[model samples]
Target: MLRRRLGVARTLKDFQGQIYGLNNLGTLLLQTGNNQAAAQSLVEALEIARSVNNEEAEGLTLSNLGLVEFARGNYFDAIKQYKAAIVLRRRFRDPLGEANTRNNLGDAYLAANLPEDAAIAYGLALQLARTTSDTPNQFRAFRGLFNSYTEAGNYPPAFRALNQHIALAKEEKDLFQELIWLRLSAQLYTITGDLANARSFYEQAIALARVLEDTGEEALLQNDLAQILYQ
Candidate 1:
């Protein structure tokens, strides 16, 4: 309806509007696990954003690029894109955008085996979330921090961050958030040689993932569980 009402002529003239459509399309494909299509659409969005010198749009497109890289397990490339997105978002004074990109940057760094760098990014993301009063991002940042610290071998900070994330997820009544946090906490515990706690959280995560019908999350947790069992 919006596109029809706007008309092709007017929409084409509005670069932002055109990019918006591309952005939505790309995001939809990304959600459906179509990395190639998502990357194509995201690149188109990036071109439009660059043409208009729209900082916000550029940041969004870069973030989307990071997602594509992550899907392909190109963690270093993902980190670069996410960092670029964060810089653009910060320059635009878009706290929410900065927070999101920071979270993605942290994830990319962690995937690249740079946990200390990931912790720094997650810390910045947490600060941005607090500044913006974005509860969801705050929760996400906490979880990111937890994982980063755990991977960095900073057990105390990791435990603290995990507890904070779990508390926030409970307050938000976000079962999915809780489930992910549980899985992460479980892995941390397993790494620290706390098998009993690891098993407990793994069971909780598996149960919640099953209920949500999230095959991706289920598979990830299964792999983690298998590793824990192996040890």
Candidate 2:
């Protein structure tokens, strides 16, 4: 269908339709792990967007291109593409797009082993996501911060971010995810020698696991709790 649209759009010389068709196709390909094909389609879309001054298409294409680069392990190139996309998204007054692009930039930074930079990008993404009431992206930003800070050994802020992430999981009523985050929080606290908090989080996770009927998680959490208690 997308290929047919691309064909029709090209025949009609409808630059906008061509851009949209190409971007959609590229995004679909990217999602399916066809990075090379995705990049080809996106590059063509980007060229057409630039030639026609289609700012929105250009921005969307750039973001898709960033995903391609990230998938290919070209972190620096991915960061560059995301930054360009973010600037265009911001200029077009698309806060949601900008926020999502920033989150992508955070992931690229993390991939490049730049935890501090990733933290900064995630912080900006969180603020933008909150402004737009994008709860999912807000959750994602916190998750990124949790990973960034934990990797950097910044335990206090990492724990704080993990707590917020878990709270958002509760808000979304995703009990299984909440249990996962709670167990991770317990581990983080344990790493920091905060046995009381570790035990508390572990207990909370155990209770939640029981509620969810996840016997395996419950058993694991109980064992972890026992180990910490022994220490």
Candidate 3:
């Protein structure tokens, strides 16, 4: 369907439709792990967007390019692309796009072991996501903050961030994500010697997993609970 759209766009000389089709193809390719093809498509899309002076499309394509770089472990290059996208997003007054790119930047920084920079980026993303009432992005920002703080050895802040992420997951009714967060909370509590909370969260996670019929996860949570009990 997307290839057909691209073909139709070409036949019609619809630069906008061509750009959109290429962008969608790039994103789909990336999601399917075809990074090389994704990069090619995104690069073409970016060129088209630039030619048309479409700042929004340019910013979005740049951000997708950053994702490709990030997936290849080129953290520095990812940061550069993300920053470029962020500049364009800000110029367009696209708060949500800027916030999303900031979160992506935070992920790159975290992967690069730059916890402080990751924290800063995630903090800004969180603030922007809140302002925009972007609940899903807010959850991502908190998850990033959790990883950043944990890597920085800031346990208190890390737990706070995890709690926030869990709250958002629950609010969104994302049971699978909530179960994951619960297990993470349990592990953190256990590491902190808060055995009571650990057991409670593990039990909650186990129960939730069972309700969802995720036997693998339920078994994992049960094993974790058993360890906590023995400890």
Candidate 4:
């Protein structure tokens, strides 16, 4: 209704709103595996954001573009987009946006196999999230750190980071985070040679993933469980 009412005007405000709507649609497309369509939508939205000189919208659209690029295995491009978004969000004093951009930066670094750089990005993201008191971002940052440390062969820090992520997830009552924490905890346990705990957590994560209808995560849990069993 609002979109229809604003259709004739099509002012800068309308363009900005359209940018937001398109960005959101792009995110949904990305999550549903339509990377090409997501990229197109994000690019269109970014153009509109630029035309309107909407810094906040531009930053968010750039972040969405970064996600699409990252999913498409264009890590360097994704990092560049994320870095630009981070600069804009920082200039605007948008801590939540900054945290999200940093998290995306961490993802790009991780994808590029630069775990130490990923760790640094995640650490900055975590600190910013804490400053904003954003529980979800805090959980994501901690999860990033956990993955970075694990890939870097820093088991102790990985385990500690995983524990921090789990604690934050519990505080937020986030079922998805709980599921991820369980899965990662299982992997960490296996790596640390805690076979019994690994098996137990893997089963728990599998059950939770089933309940959540998260087939991708369930598949990962199954694979990890198989590997642990073989070990």
Candidate 5:
């Protein structure tokens, strides 16, 4: 249906419609893991956006392209595209777009083993997300910070980041994510020899899992809680 609309839009010389169609198709393709097709669609959309002087559309398309490259393990290329998108987003004064691109850039940096750079990008993303009241991006930025700090062996900061993520997850009412974060917090506390916190979080996670009827997760958390108690 999207392709048909794109074809009709193209024939009618409807640049805006064509761009929208292309972006939609690209996003769908990307979500479905069709990197090559997604990239092609996004590239065409980007060209149209540029020709039409649509900075917002251009930034969005570039971000999609970055995602395609990132999924293909081309971290450098993804970073390049993300930087381009960030530039356009900043120019347009779009805080949410800027935050999203920055988060993507952080992920690319992490994938490239540049933990410090990832942390910097994530910091900016987090600030931008907060400024825009973009909770989802804020969560992503926190997750990125956690991963970057962990990679850099910054244990305390990593734990702080994880706590922030868990807090946000709870705010969003994402029980599954909250459960996962609680489990991770328990493990982190255990690793750092904070047995009291570890036991508390583990028991909390187990109780939550039991309430959710997640038998597997409850059993796992119970086992971890028992191990910590024995230690």
Candidate 6:
């Protein structure tokens, strides 16, 4: 049915409608694990976008192609596509697009085992997200930074990025998520030899666990907190 509509749009030479349909169908195909079909649709969309000189549409199609390549484990290909999209996004003055593409580029860099590059990309994404007041993307950028730093064995920076994520997440007031982040914060602090901070986080998690009536988690946190205090 969707393809039929796309066919109609194509036959009518409805450039805008056709491109939108193709991009949407491509995304749906990717979600369903039909990478080949997704790529085909996206390729057609890219051709149409380029032919029509629609940089924004071209950038979007390129970004979708990046995801297809990433899913296929072609990190370099994904990076190429995302970089292309970023250039177009920047040229078009699309902060949101640039932020998203930069984040995707970070993921590609990370997948390519280039944590430093990933960190750089994620840092840029974070700044862009912050500038645009895009809270969700800011959270995503911070999460990516945390992972990138962790992968690079840079514990302090990783902890800082993760701490920012926790701060932002606290606004959501998801108790279970809070408990999890507190536990992770404690672990990261322990790794960094920040015993006092570790103890504080562990204590926080323990109290939350008690509130949630999670006796097992409470016991674990208490034991960990005790060990930290003994230090």
lDDT of each: 0.86, 0.92, 0.91, 0.89, 0.91, 0.89
Query: Which 10 residues in a row give candidate 4 its minimum summed lDDT?
Result: 1-10
**Candidate 5's residue-wise lDDT over 86-192, tens digit each?**
99899999998899999999999999999999999999999999997898899889889988987887898998898788888878898877887888889878877
Candidate 2 segments whose C-alpha is farther than 4 A from its true place: 193-231
- What is candidate 6's lDDT per residue for 145-201, written digit by digit as tens? 877887888988887887788887788776876787788788778877889889889
Tens-place lDDT digits, model 2, residues 52-171: 898887998999899999999999999999999988998999989989999999999999999999999999999999898898789889989988999899988997898788777888
Best candidate, TM-score: 3
Root-mean-square deviation of each candidate, in angstroms? 3.8, 3.1, 2.1, 3.4, 2.8, 4.6
On residues 93-197, what C-alpha lDDT tens digit does candidate 1 reach at each position?
Answer: 999888988988988888999999988988998998988789978987888888788777789999999888888889889988888788888878888899999
Total clashes for model 2: 0
Clashes of each: 0, 0, 0, 0, 0, 0
Residue 37, candidate 4: Cα error in Å is 3.3
Q: Which stretches of candidate 4 lie over 4 Å from their true place?
A: 1-13, 173-176, 203-227
Candidate 3 whole-model C-alpha lDDT, 0 to 1: 0.91
TM-score against native, each model: 0.78, 0.85, 0.90, 0.81, 0.86, 0.80
Clashing pairs in 6: none
* Deviating ranges (above 4 Å) for candidate 3: 166-177, 226-231
What residue runs in model 6 are displaced by over 4 Å at the alpha carbon?
Answer: 172-180, 183-231
Candidate 6's TM-score reads 0.80
Error of 6 at 214 (Å): 13
lDDT of 4 by residue, 1-231 (tens): 534533533554668668877887789899999999999888988998898799888999899999999999999999999999998898889999999899999999999999999999999999999997988789888989999999999999998898888777788788999998898899888888899999999999999999999999899889989997986
Best first by TM-score, ranked? 3, 5, 2, 4, 6, 1
Q: How far off is residue 144 in model 2, in Å?
A: 0.7
